[model samples]
Target: MDFDLPESAAAVREGVQAIAREYDQAYWDRCDAEKRWPEEVWRDLVAGGWHSLAIPEEYGGAGQGLLELAVALESLAEGGAGGAASFMYLLTPAFGGLTIARHGTGAQRREFLPRIASGELETCFAITEPDAGSNAIEIATRARLDGDHYVVSGQKIWISGVERADFLVLVARTIPAAEAKPRTNGFTVLLVDVKEAVADGTLSYRPIPKLGTNTVASSMVFLDEVRVPAERVLGAPDEGFAVLWDILNPERILAAASGVGFGELVLRHACDYARDRAPFGRPIGTNQAVAFPLARIKAQLELARLMTHKAAWLWDAGRPCGSEANIAKLTAADAAWQAADRAFQTYGGMAYSLEYPIARMFRDARIAKNIPVAEELVLAHIAQHELGLPRSY
Candidate 1:
């Protein structure tokens, strides 16, 4: 419940921002225009150790909590875009390595965590299917047992970083739906080597064109009877849902934090434009029409920031944070959207022009409401968990 970050956390933010400042908006703008990934920035982050800040010290990481991780990611988004945050977190062990750390055995950790912490390897988590979407349990991907390996067959859409990742954390059904003890049962998690699968023609991928965050490539991946070593199975054979909890909370919180940063960046731009633009012999900001709404968005962003920090703190402390994480993501996404819209409106016709960064930030902010988890889904979780309403889905 601490309102202020500890000195160590503050130092992490300062260090990350210092490196991020080297890449200005113009550089990011060019990257976005070309649909190019930020390889230079990614390498710089890795060199500075900001990429491995969250991994445990024993595993060659700094062992920082999620709050510090959230702050660092938020600053990156504020400094650049969600692409930068994605590069930092997606490239790190947080996505798959953390899942393995929580549910992995000593052998698994020894096999993967250190290499992941050092950025020697990367993993992409494949869970979303075309038919399943948010209904993860409805996915039809199957992993059947073999002599010393499991044969996996499935299709996943919107799987990010697959082209560059060395391994994949895959979710597949180990038990048939008819025999599943619960609707969520029968799902299994496995880590598969991407190179071997592709070489064997068991895995294939095609890049998916997206509107934003183009720096991180997402793809439609197919796994046709891919063989994964038995040791690659994470947690139990049919307990993927439990294993996902360790990853999703951090994902939601990190997304919320990124939203807050984007909002702040928009607010700064809007305020600057409002102060300089003159209409009717007075600054446009003089009219309460523009100024009041902008002020409100500023307030909303601050409020979302508080909630995001709280959610990250609770999650890092090993407390149950499903409710808080949902609210944090919902509030921050809404606030960012509001701020981006106001920024667009404040910029008038110029807002629609690509020359101004607000237009891109607006598009990026809108995407925040949809991905990582949609706002509608967040509301559903809140209604059920926070208000004690019956589950809608």
Candidate 2:
């Protein structure tokens, strides 16, 4: 079997790498420290047309798929920005472009895809609620029909990029969970105009202070009687569980890519430092203690990356990829955390200093273990679904 990336994915890597290289670790460090967005890198990505990779050619895009988008995110993380940079691809192309391209009506496609392709607009996803957390079926966000529009009210937590987003892909309940026969029934997906809702005072958000990935803000979003046009329904009303799956699988795969890339970034830094810093008349890398753990982490990184690629490929092929996606995210998150921990250990106390990027990377690498999908939930899925065991939750 061929293990190589397709030519298209290779080209995506090269293109994104060229841009990522322009922004050094110091640049990212400054951005994180100042809690600033990397506008320069974003402009360069737009200029390079990387954002258009997933948009269909008919909609002013390159007509690529999730595999290529995952590659772009991974390469960008490995190149410099760490796992935090995955938002560049996740917020727009994966969540907006791919979802709308596949599930949106023709008019919806026409309205959003081209703008997304051209980087003229940005979108954020909102699914997790203050109480729901990983139990998405328990979400209480409600969107009731009001004539031609749906009046939505809900609270969403840990939503990324809301401040900068022009649009939001919102998941709400048209039928209350208690009333719906099947747990997944009664769900509806709506596309809300963020700026309009905010201006009307129906939508507001407060940023949550976080431990890392300070470059982009995550917020607690409140939607109170927000009106969304009926035309903005992303999929068939009250049958959005299927649409939610499509969005979720891609999210897991891209997040896996981010973890693998972040692992590579930290591992590279560890290897470089280990080879150069010789304190006791020999490079620390020469010792088995430092050398062996790095080697093991390198193996883990490669294995996780392979699973990530397989998940993305399965998604592009329109195959059932839930098992693969969960596995990829779980393994990649563990690998990234291990790599960051070892890298920090390899650098000794110097890792704590701001002069080095390890502390920042360590902080960034950690969030992947919990967000998008938690490691414990992934394990639960595998335990029940893959093993054919009884449901635990």
Q: Against the unseen true structure, what C-alpha lDDT does each candidate score?
A: 0.83, 0.93
Tens digit of lDDT per residue, candidate 1, span 1-393?
A: 457888868998898788778988888888878877787887776777777777678888787778887888888887766434655564454676567666888898888888877768888888899998877778899999999899999899999889988988888999877789887898888999999999999999999987777777889999999999988889888887888777778888888888888888788889999999997788899989999999998889889989898998888788999888888889998898998899999999999889988877877788878878988999999888888999998
What digit string (tens of lDDT, one per residue) describes model 2 on residues 1-393? 889999999999999999998888999999999998889999998888897798899999988999999999999999998976789889988889999999999999999998988889999999999799999999999999999999999999999999999999999999999999798999999999999999999999999999998888999999999999999999999999999999999999999999999899999999999999999999999999999999999999899999999999999999999999999999999999999999999999999998999999988888889978989899999999999988888
Best by lDDT: 2
Tell me the deviation in Å of residue 105 in model 1. Answer: 1.9
What is the Cα-based lDDT of residue 239 in candidate 2?
95
Itemize residue pairs with steric clashes in candidate 2: none
Candidate achieving the largest TM-score: 2
Model 1 error, position 22 (Å): 0.8
Off by over 4 Å in 1: 82-84
RMSD of 1: 1.6
RMSD after CA superposition, every candidate: 1.6, 0.7
